[model samples]
Target: MSIKINTYITILMLSSAAFISPLITKGQSTSLDSSQPETVVQKKYGLDPSKPLAKRIGNTPPEIIQKFRDAGMSPTLHRLSKTDSLKVVRAFQMLPPLHQHILKEHLLGISFLDNMPNTALTATVNPEDQFPVFTITFRAEILKQDVSQWLTEKEMSYFTKDFPGFRIAIEAGKLDAILYVLLHEATHVVDGSLGILAMDQNKGTSGMAVNLKSFTRNIWVDRTSICPSYTDSLTSQSRFRGGGRLLPMELARQIYQSAAKGPFVSLYATSSWHEDLAEYLTVTHFTKRLKQPFRIIIHEGRKEIFIYEPMKSATVSSRISLMKYFYAKAGSSVLYERHVKPGGRGFNG
Candidate 1:
């Protein structure tokens, strides 16, 4: 779409802060009390301290068993409900053979539950749908008791600002927060299983549109920007001025190009598209399936991150027209084909 690449870069750097935060140890106890001020210990050796214990174990598969032993904790993966565990396993078995292999290769041998002195949290997968689902549940009373121990061990005040909500939640046995966090991470695993993250190996000129057959829809790129006059009108209003609204199509095109310039996209469009599409699909699918309206809340003084939502009005004829516009501007074929089946469905990768 011939965007000023520099402008796009600026937007990305600014917007990343809100959506991207340093990973926090998922299962670790934190002393977030007022006196403690939520201090974080940065990981040494490039390890992600925020990863779940099971993931940490999985990451260094062979060493995990030894590390747990050395630490003198008898590590046992907690099993939630037998029925739920069976359902999750059956769901995994029902996936396509290749996907099953991917799941086993990537996620097998990982523990789904952790037991602490006073509390326990167990992870479970729900596979009763088209995609695999992961969840975590906590034993409320035990979790609070454990949290109290954590705070005391860290020598932190219980009344601190950061600790208030967390302490209250833990004491009340409100597991929704933990549940949401697990759901978010589990979504990542599901995306990978669906081959939504594969890379397109086809080498072609810049600005060429690549058909992503795995998505069951054609992603079209067109050379267009929001009408200057319309953008000017929107900018005059403080509400829209924050990020400056653009036409939905134009916004999508800008994001597509910006993502194309990202690290993974250089080596493989498919892989890059996987993350891009995952973000897109998550936002869209959540809105549709959960009935939550999509909203982008921007902080004006801060940097901007671009959000793209596919057009509900998009049609094959309209997509063709958009492709032609880019083809004419690039003066090249500007089209790389991926196979799609009739009835608008196909394998993702």
Candidate 2:
């Protein structure tokens, strides 16, 4: 039963990555301001030019012209509700100081997009800025929608038991799940902005190459050593989508049991290197900082089936050191000391 659960969870995670939508989607046919230069964008937006972003962005506040606003990309899209808007804004602010600085400045702008299904969250390199000015677009419906209903029965049951307020928080628009999704997508923006995970492209048409020099390699190889089934090719990889391949309820139960003994935080973490890093960081932040529990228990008519506590996984727990280095802030360090083990090796590279 446990082995079957592991197999299906693995399949669901990998499939979720394979079907992620494109990063940038245009609305109302709004073209980018490609003529704008990097320096000019920085100056115009009041972003800090002195502080350059490489891989490790230190803890510093950014000078941002705008915090959050409409994308002006489309007329069809409507404004987000006050509760939802405040929730999103507060979520960004809740990030550790180090990440707060990077996001405030480089994040550029955030807008609501109703065109996409609630399941979609997208980011794009703002055309107005040459140096990684990102405009994040969230499917507006997501904030008001009960996305948890989309989870598989096994996932639903596990979360309900593990995270006490899981469904209630989602309904009230206060769950870390929304914040987790935001942080995960925001990581991509930071990764692209800092060249931490650059897309390798050749001069001709051999298709883009995969480079693991930065965060990608650290997660795929140095950290968890992601299963080959998830990383055989870029096409097979998965991101942090709310949906994945569905399995029979019985099979789903088996998969969850098998996953309990695995190294990854959640089954979704096995989708790809990028997702692995994002999922690890998000879950750690949720469980450690937010005081939430990430455990899995299956029951067959009252008898215990299996139990999996993510924070206790040998492989998953080892990455706490890397998380500390990634943030390198007082709060994150303290969180690590309080929740995760005292120390381990920091970032792989």
Candidate 3:
């Protein structure tokens, strides 16, 4: 079976502003009336500043707008919500203000449905006339379960030797599975936006196709786009598990060994360059820069067989440099702090 690389990568990846001026009303009061029983009339508006920008203003689709509204979030906003509205609102508020703004400006909407079909977090773009509308969806319950299962002694040890505080953060609620998924997916959006991993619209169709652009220091150019190389690599991999496949013991060891020798960040990253970039950003941001320990330990009847630590790979650090290119183009001050390392460019250099 053949899968369109751009659309397939999008499906499998696992992972705005305003101004105003007001005119004076004929009988507007400058001061509040204390004694005359002032009647406060509330006015209703179509768009919200705190929510995702409206399609008219930001090019988000009407259907997505309605979906968020039905979920009690925002109409044209990059809003977030779950089945229960209040919890999602509070969770959204818990994020840093700059983080929230970056998301709201770039994203169209976020929905926490309990019945998402794929990974805990996945992204899809609804192409628009002006700018593509990106929507990120999450299944909170399934996502938590996926993260727990992925970090098992058996699975973790085979992937890397760099122990991360990911499990600890999950337990403490400081680093949630949903949040991790969101960040990974968000990196994809940032990548596409920066033209680092450029996406081209399929001719005469509404679908998107991956356009692998060359990565220089400052700009992304489409000279020798390696579209086939990425797609071929992804398809050549075994699909024992749906997304990227977790292999059997011997094969898995060989795969991880090969990955360690490669420029990819994680096992899943080997699937495609897009994924390679996403995992690179996600793992580095959480593990090295954040000073978190993402360690893995495995035992066989009483003996420990293997352990994985992702941050120790030189190849992984090299992939992280690509993010410096991304951050520089995004020009977001928050992004710098999010990915920037102390003495070097990004994520422990």
Candidate 4:
């Protein structure tokens, strides 16, 4: 079980049902009751109309999307209906090239091919089985301002208030948080794919040791020791509690505090990380690979405080020194490329 083989197996298994039509051979409608309040229906393998098989087992579809929308749910996050199996197939067909590539790659790495049936596959959970199909239902209306406010209180400010209907907080600029969540969830999926307790299996092993080492090194050396000047006492308390004995990076601590709030917490905080990482990566990719800089700012309005990088050379150098100090403490070397032609770039030393 290589990662590639696992992904292919998973894709093949999912494709059997996900790519098929919902209409049965008997020409009977397979649609579930749209009026049902519960968004998800995990039913046994049967032809029950109440728990339509088509919706629960395949890719998403337009009719299913309509049903969800009519029910005031976010279609982007709902499962397909039994009657609209074809829609699920088509939606898979509509997936963007990058998304499809990533999905296929991920599936191949998880050993999903072995469990796929020769005939059409139905969603089921056998007592002895691994690899369960997850139906993630997205309800946009429920994630309105109330949810957004909760995120704000947790100090996750990297979200957009513009999208009124349905916005995945992961999209707004929180790439770090999103990536962390993805990795964490994907770790679970890998365990299921391998039919082993992935975490427990690695306990006391070299792999676990490396992971712990990286975490410890990052916390003690690479991370900022001082709390962000803007961090409120409540947020500090939350971070201390959530992080336990681990020395959290300032940004990481802020994110952990925010994520402890609720479901939205993880999304909000992770998205912020995503953005930070993305920006850091982008800068590194285009310019020379360098350490990230840190700075502080004070806001006149509401007597609030914030932190950011300044466009001045002196300020940038100071931030860079802090980054270097942290990185060096973590037992990592900093490699700087020869300065390319500087064209009025404020901090291109």
Kindly list the per-residue Cα lDDT of model 4 for residues 65-160, writing each as its tens digit: 443345444424333344233533443333223223222322211111112111111111221212132222222222222312322322222222
lDDT of 3 at 186: 64
Q: Per-residue alpha-carbon lDDT of model 1 for 217-303, expressed as tens digits? A: 323121112223222332222111234322232233233344333221111112223323323433333344334433221112244
Model 3: residues with Cα > 4 Å off, grouped in runs: 1-8, 11-49, 52-102, 121-125, 142-174, 199-236, 240-246, 296-298, 325-349
TM-score of 2: 0.57
TM-score of 4: 0.27
Global lDDT of each candidate: 0.26, 0.43, 0.38, 0.24
lDDT of 3 by residue, 260-340 (tens): 555545555544455566666666666655455554434444555555556677744654544444333344442423111
lDDT tens per residue, model 2, 90-173: 677656554665465566556555444233333444432235455555555556533232223325432223322222111112
Q: What is the lDDT of candidate 2?
A: 0.43
Score candidate 1 by TM-score against the native: 0.27
Error of 2 at 341 (Å): 34
What TM-score do all the candidates reach, one by one? 0.27, 0.57, 0.54, 0.27
Better candidate number, 3 or 4, judged by lDDT: 3
How much RMSD separates candidate 4 from the native structure? 19.8
Best by lDDT: 2
